[model samples]
Target: MSGAFMGPPWQMDWVDTARAARDSLPRRVRDLIDAVRAELVTVEDPYFRGVDNLPDLPEGCRISPLLSTVPSGLHVCHFDHGRGWIHYTFLRRTADPQIVVEEVFWQ
Candidate 1:
């Protein structure tokens, strides 16, 4: 994988699935969730703290930056289940830095 200093914060857009979750969540919680989601999509190498009992995702599952690290040019799109559950999937890259490839979400 390529290496570089963590750049500015980026906003990961709410994928259709995530948007549905945001819409169903409590207002206060939704705001925080949306903010975090946006941050993950826009930046490269965003900071993430670890979460307890996090499930083992599939080979190409998307995860939160708060729970995982995203490398430059790679990104995970969010999908909300409207039950306080969120899921993500790896998206194909468009332009350079358009996706989050590496993650420090456990750090």
Candidate 2:
């Protein structure tokens, strides 16, 4: 198992990368991403808070640890906004309480 994640105030790493991806998306897709952000902002830890309360998420969207990457145990918050899925990986730093988003991938 990975080390314990510190609490609250999620942060994103390489935000510009995510932004550029968002900028290239169609407006409808962008709106979906916006909606995900809106939902996420309401909670302190998207990965740990659990998705049971996020009613807006599509069928496959849920918070789960990456199975293939066990031991490292990276947690992901998956959301299917449109035809694609937005997968966010959360990395916890020892010194920070914020969950640093290590990556955001659309697939």
Candidate 3:
């Protein structure tokens, strides 16, 4: 919500720390993320958007809220099929409709 004007409904971007973490990942895992990114970029609110009360998770990823520190507006999307890696992202205010990647880690 800073002075910067947002352009689209569902834009995807990563903070520097998150970008570094994603950069360190191998190609296959990165491919999973790229796939998720494609889906996320089309959803207006990845954290809250849903249909028929089901969670709106990107394909190949399972999501849960990040509850330790910043509880609200923060979430982790983890690989659902036997993978231990997790990707973190958060949405800003309506004026800045962007999903900002917060972190990436392995569990």
**TM-score, cand. 1 vs. native:** 0.37
lDDT of 3 by residue, 1-107 (tens): 46664544467778798788778888877777777776666654566545553444445676667765555657777763636455556556546567778777643
Q: Candidate 1's residue-wise lDDT over 29-75, tens digit each?
A: 55645555565554343333146533333222344433334342233
Worst 10 residues of 1 by lDDT: 98-107
TM-score sort, best first? 3, 2, 1
The candidate maximizing lDDT is 3
The 10-residue segment of model 2 with minimum total lDDT is 49-58
TM-score of each: 0.37, 0.54, 0.66
Candidate 3, poorest ten consecutive residues by summed lDDT: 49-58
| Candidate 1 positional error at 64, Å | 6.9
For every candidate, C-alpha RMSD to the true structure in Å: 10.4, 5.6, 4.4
Better of 1 and 3 by TM-score: 3
Put down candidate 2 lDDT per residue, 13-97, tens digits, no spaces: 4356767787688886667666666555446555554335544544545666666556345656566633454445555565544
Models ranked on lDDT = 3, 2, 1
Clashes of each: 23, 0, 0
